[model samples]
Target chain A: MLKKGIKYTVALILLLIVGYNSVYIKKLSEVKAAAATGKFDATLYAQTFWQEKLTPGLAKANNLPELLTLLKSDKENAFKNYSHALGIGNLRYFLIKGIGKITASNENDISVTLLPDSVGQEVKLATEFVYGNAVRDALGILSINDFSNTMDMNNVSAEINKKIRTEIIPPFRAQAKKSDVVAFTGAIELNQVHLRLDEIEVIPVSLNLIQK
Target chain B: MSPKVFVKEEKAQVQPPTLKAPAFSGSYSRYLVKFQSLIALFILCLIISLLSDKFLTVANGWNVMRQISVNICISVGMTLVVLTAGIDLSVGSVLALCGAITAGLLKFGIELPSQDLFIGFTLLGVVLAGLLTGTLLGTFNGWTITRFKVPPFVATLAVLTIARGLTMLYTKGFPISGLGADFAYIGTGWLLGIPVPVWISGIIVGLAVFLTNKTRLGRYIYAIGGNESAARLSGINISKVKTTVYAIAGGLAAIGGIIVTSRLDSAQPNAGISYELDAIAAVVIGGTSLSGGRGSILGTVQGAIIIGVLNNGLVLLNVSPFWQQVVKGMVILLAVIIDKANSKSE
Candidate 1:
């Protein structure tokens, strides 16, 4: 009886030890996945984030008119309703995907103002609305808490932005002929309140020339 | 008396001592298996603790328990099946299928009139759907094995592919997320400073120990496994016991699935791919003979911890995941080889 008691105690202790190790492993893996800065594929990361987070969030979002009403009625509530953040609302992210034309460009920034295909009768889209890095900042899809430390996230975002600038712009800029139609899926921030009704700058994660 | 007997050795014609087999009631070497798994677990704990300071900490202690909860849930059921000398290869796939179904059902809610009461019922429905899917698929595996006279390996392997395919088809190979905070609570929430999955699995282990030790079905399972012909001669329902075991395995797999989905907050169709192997290894390591009729859930519990510790320790040491797989394979091989040697001696 004494021997059996000892054995059971040992087994119990063993299980407890094993269980503790399990916790350590889980926390370590979480830290590991979040801390990775430069080693993974950027396109894959961006694409997955776009598809998994941005697209779904956008699909569930209210339309422009409905959103405008919400904004007017309750700006805080509107932001609360529309916003999603990895860190319990640290930074907000939004998605805007539709057909539009590039009405203007900044040669230095390679940035473009998009005229959305559909225009409201009385309201025009904003001109001050910038899409690219500014949109990236507002969307806050790649926040540090769920992903990385602030520094690592900045570095990764910079790399992704660079990949977009060097690879995406040269081909896109060469084909920017008159009367060209471009379809874009991009991200935007809700805080850009002073934008023209017809003008919105979208950071094109994927941009295409519909016709030239 | 001993001196007199020694002096009488010549008179007794130098009688040799008879070798008595180590016994459990009447069985030979019965306690060997009980000790072997315990010793293995002890060795694992010793090695891990010595190598890493992180191994013996309190926070990690709960972490291991929480992480191994799903593994325990699955392996406990596996212990029964392996004792019957049958295997459930489709358990991982069943987990994926059940998890996907559970999440999908939550998303595929009925157009309820009210939000408050309806959410409660809908959640209940989701849990039932997950369990039912697991049970039904497990039943199919049992049916093929018993009725069609198909081998357990081939039948479960086929089911693995079929269920996995169905899981992917159901979700278009994408993970289903947004399962709600309430759904997540079952896995991630702590009732009393312990993770919920740990509580869930602990209850399952208690129930399993009771069922196998105290129930008629348990006796029939062992009897059938020990000697199928003798069990049949004694009028034991072999097919029924076998089917029930598989069914229980399936239901248990679903429990694992739901726990994983809740923990991850999503159900990827690809989730649980090859998880069955780990569960099987745990059973085998627990000193359960793969040859049937001889294993206990208690041993499997230790076996699972052994594996969990090894994986955990290796990672804490900064070992590569690739090397971890190799070590796991070796552990399984070493366990089976020892089992073979022990069986030979028996």
Candidate 2:
């Protein structure tokens, strides 16, 4: 009877612990999903859009036939292609390939690891776009200001602004435009090009790509 | 048959006997040699005073006191534990755990709804957490030693690793910072021109003295350390008493951790990593036998003061930090040698 009582109590305790953990995990997942769409989500969307622009657009399209013919006949208008046509090709690559590996899912609130391999082999651009000290992350970083002390969001905003301005902004400026040259098998594979002018807006856009 | 005659007869019957001289002089010379710690402390202070100009300064002395305050406080408890032939390697980790719990409680409290309960409950929670954690750990060490019949060294060594690992797990290798202002006052603030830590250490040392000198529980600890089998035969409730000793030691260690964290304004998971070594060294240097029994609180106090002075003097002299460790170890060895030589002669 003593052994039976002990077994029953142990089983009940284990069940309660498991149940509690499951509920806690479910709540955590919900919070993470909600977080993926907030102001922080703007960066994720922009990165996704760049990744989609790379493989699908240029990999499928061929020759700027009309633009090339115009270019062959009139060399003076080539400057227009440089500003308009070349820029479009660069943007497309940036959106499709460059941005894919720049952002990924966060495992926890205070932790994030950028998955560079999501794009392609020899992913150099992905490394440049990601910021944050892996050592400090492991050792843990303290957020300035007590989140509980005041009803003030100013401290949080200040910290976020410092990180964005100091660490994030400069890199974005450098990688803002994408490369016009696309190489496949060690040669420039610029067989086709499509130059599209879309109106720029404050609203963020995400490029969606489905591989064939 | 008058009253005067009766008084005279009683006086004659109660006549005082002539006094005889004591066999030996009650000279302090004998005691001065026995308490070699007092001699070593005097020599150390003299040497430091002669070596450095800044050593005597008020500000620098305060700094030294502040630095060694936690060590001094914890060594008193360690002295008691060692007196019972038990080692407490877990004290350092216990300190870290207590500090982390204090930080966590405060952080959780601050995040809760702003009510009186938040602050009150937070303080209570932190203190209770320290007490509970320390007592639990001490009990575990005691149980392992007594029940499993494991040697105290082996048992406490296991506890040392386990407690440190748990501390790392709790903080995730991070330091918990931004404790409340009031909490910081315990370590940082001063009372009557002395740092609060010094005052706290003084009070604890006094309490430790009273426990070791005045109480039955304290006597039993020394007795058990002196002879375990004898104490057991005398019905001293060996298990319960030993457990209580460890629990007290653990609790005192937790207090040390709290004071240290508050002083630094953070609970670094690795803060108290090697503090236990210094504590043990202090106890041994104080003329306490490592084999257990036969030590005084006064000697340990002197030992702690000697260590505090040596560390302060080294820094004041601007000696290389690496070499300072070598010097300190040599000094401890030297003091132990002096103590042993003195005891043998006695």
Candidate 3:
């Protein structure tokens, strides 16, 4: 009887271990699936998982899109978030792709190219395509998916507010500059873009001409 | 009973001739734990390298080292704290607070760039600032743990939330920027083809190793960890030792914060969240007993590298971030289970 009891206990333990392993495998598989899809609905998953499992205060406090950016920036952070909310792991792939340009070709529908700028490397649109009668407006559509996520929308609005009020509007209003504009585009617009500078250093030049 | 009968009875029990054998048993067990952990770390690193081409790159290797340095520094101190059966969850938040203060000082030039904020003076002042802040916070934790008899886990957990909240209030939700080029150099620069953060971490690890192996204080730490009541009976100053251990932990965590801020060139008030767990994980993987009294600095360094390689390799392979977490959790769980089995055998 004792031997039989021991066998039963061992079997139970093995079953528990297998169950745990199965759950882990499932979570990992889900994360991988979500990461593969560029347009997966991360917000829905984040909200649902948070509501069902995570602490309510934490769920409500975290700004999902900003947190998504933070996770993609570092692997350790990504793993840490994935361990907590698997939804974060799924969103990070899209977040990184978003940071760079996403290109669509005839066969290769999406590719991203990095460009070196004054500040740092930035993703620029490579395709010459226009949407809704505007060439520059096409860039706006790329970020529209980002805005569709409510959490990301909040971050964008906050950044735009900060730039408009604390940066652009103050200087423009002070100098009475009328033509300054802020546009979100994937590529540079030749004629429509306005240049704004906080300070400029001028160099003096001498030109000598002889007339006959 | 006859002498022959007594001898036969003792032989039947397989009793050793002396108690010294069991005394030596503990050391042997410790050695086994260390060996097993080293083997695990070796296998982990090997697997990661084979799986990802990017893992073996010189630049990526340096980046991994640079990335793990801060966490390792904190783990070195954390190992000591945990050895005394205590914890410091506030390390992460403390790191942010220190970074914020340091960057805030730099932004306004509270000290003049050349005159007052020369390398020697500025660096010294920053170190002192970190030390003071860390020590005070650690001392606060130690005091509550000792005086109020609070559990290390609960007390430190409370401090973690409080410190993070204070950081947000202090920074008003924006990162502190405009640090000096000199300050930024610590994070980005290299010495002898190695990043400064890596060099600094190496020095810190060496110091911890020396302290643990070659000092009387180190002996007491193990003694306290092995058995607190017995250690107190032996006349070790329990409260003082505990306080000092936690203070050192805080100071070490502060150094990590300094390194991170320098690298980013700005101090994000919210940076370093969940850092305590990484430090603890590294310490445990290195074969440190969570219950305290058994660990080594060298082991912790190896553990840190294992985690660093895992992170870097996964990114290089472009493994879905979700799966990476699953893998990490499994590794940690396995390590812990192995550690427990080894402990029981000892």
Say which candidate scores most in DockQ.
Answer: 1
Could you give candidate 2's per-residue lDDT for residues B1-346 as a string of tens digits? 6999999878866764411122133245566667667777888888888998888888987888888888887788789889999888989988888888777666543322322223323454576667678778888888888888888889988988988898889889977776768888988999998899999888998998999999999899999999999999999998888888888888888888889888877888897887888888788788887768778777777778888888888877878889989998997788678767766765
Which lDDT tens digits does candidate 3 get at residues A1-212? Answer: 99999999999998776545322212334444554785435455434433453222222222223433454465465333332211222211111112222222222112322221222232222222211111112112223333333334334333432333343333322422122221212112111112111111100010011111
lDDT of 1 by residue, A18-105 (tens): 5453222123333345537634465676656555865564455334445545666776786676654543422345455555455545
Model 3, residue B238: what's the lDDT? Answer: 87
**For every model shown, what is its TM-score relative to the native structure?**
0.62, 0.59, 0.59
Query: Interface Cα RMSD per model, in Å?
Result: 16.7, 12.8, 23.4
List, residue by residue over B1-346, the lDDT tens digit for candidate 1. 8989778876556444322322333353466555888777788888889989999999888888888888898999888888888989999999999999898877544323433212222566688779989999988988889899899999999999999999999999888876778898998999988899989999999999998899999888888778888999999878888999999999999999999999987898899987899999999988888878988888888888888888888887878789999999999999999989888876
lDDT of each: 0.74, 0.63, 0.63
B1-346 per-residue lDDT for model 3 (tens digits): 6999989987857866455676697678766665876777678678877887666678887889999999898999899998887778989998898787776655432433333231222554565565677777888878888888899899889888887888798789888765667888888898898899999999999999888899978888888998999999999998888888888888888888888888877789888998998898888888888898888888888888887877777877777789988887887788799988887875
- Which residue pairs collide in model 3, if any? A104-A109
lDDT of 1 at B139: 88
lDDT of 2 by residue, A1-212 (tens): 99999999999998777545322112334444554664233243323323453223334322233323444565345323322222222221111112222222222111111123331322222212222221111111223242322212233333433443445444443433333122110001121233321211111111222111
lDDT comparison, 1 vs 2, better candidate: 1
Chain A TM-score from candidate 2: 0.20
For candidate 1, give the lDDT. Answer: 0.74
In angstroms, how far off is B217's CA in candidate 1?
0.2
Give the Cα error of residue B119 in candidate 2, in Å. Answer: 11
